[model samples]
Target: MAFDYDDNNIFAKILRGEIPNNTVAENDVALAFRDIAPKAPVHVLVIPKGKYVSFDDFSANASDAEIAGFSRLCAEVCAKEGVGLDAGNAGFRAITNAGPDGVQEVPHYHLHIMGGRMMGPMVLLRD
Candidate 1:
């Protein structure tokens, strides 16, 4: 599938500072913030400052610095939020949903950090 960046997307607006967010951490290449609709006790989102429709798109198009910075910011945010390795072996879950099947609600690529409690299996098994 072709990945196109949409300037009008909500994340793009947030990156542009056109919309305010509950920012957790931010650097030159990325921003981390509390998810408005959190699925876990500690839920945060890390997004690239640039336009990226999916993880694949970001990984393929973004510069090495951008990729590295974005990754570092994700770990930094998780640590700052108290879900770091010190929190226990469970650590935290950093996930990115891609495409329609993944239920990606936004067009921009983002990582969701979830922790602070035990999580169930990634998917439900159907008979």
Candidate 2:
């Protein structure tokens, strides 16, 4: 579905307490919630608290602290969810689709972290 970009994105609304979500984690700079449509058992969408139209927008507007916070938050969430670093040899996949051409259904920049089960290779449309 094409994400609504005119109004504040759904995720941003969620962040602003204007909407509800199955939140998994939250920090000053980001929020993590379950994907409405999950591709894996533990699929969560990690979104920046700050609103950005797209990945490119985020890249341009995000500060070093924002970038570092996002990186650390990913690791922290993965560990907390026991998705990759648990004793079970389980692993996780983190994905972020950039633009419409990249399959980004949402205009808001977010990261998808999937785990609680093993996943296949990173190749897309490959044998």
Candidate 3:
């Protein structure tokens, strides 16, 4: 019922240098790396370095600098991957899941940057 943080999560380990990651970009507040099981051409996982359970958690508790840094890092990822609208590219998708219903596999605040092709429907309608 609480948005608790797990320091031993994979992302946490990656941040702690316990696990290796193909880093794309990073700043004092976050780290962006290629996903191990990528679902798209540019599947980068951007995670805040702080201990937060979800986006809401990070957004609510993070300092202004961390928020800004994380956002800038996300934009950097899109730009570096050539998926931003500033380019002639079609663009990319940024996804963040929370809790069980959202199917968040990790208990760390993170954003998934997916692009390089049409992603189809955002989600299939259950109807």
The number of the candidate with the highest lDDT is 3
lDDT per residue as tens, model 2, 1-127: 3444535667767877898899888777888888898989889888887767666677888988887787778777887788866556468898888766677866788989998776887866845
Question: What pairs collide in candidate 2?
Answer: none
Q: Please, what are the lDDT tens digits per residue for candidate 1 over residues 7-112?
A: 8999999888899999999999999999999999999999998888999989999999999999899888877988899656467788998988788889999999
Per-candidate TM-score against the hidden true structure: 0.92, 0.83, 0.96
The clash count of every prediction, one per candidate, is 0, 0, 0
**Model 2 CA deviation exceeding 4 Å by range:** 1-5, 86-88, 123-127
Lowest lDDT block of 10, candidate 2:
1-10
Clash pairs for candidate 1: none
Candidate 3 has which clashing residue pairs, if any? none
Alpha-carbon runs more than 4 Å astray in model 1 = 86-89, 125-127
CA deviation > 4 Å runs, candidate 3 = none
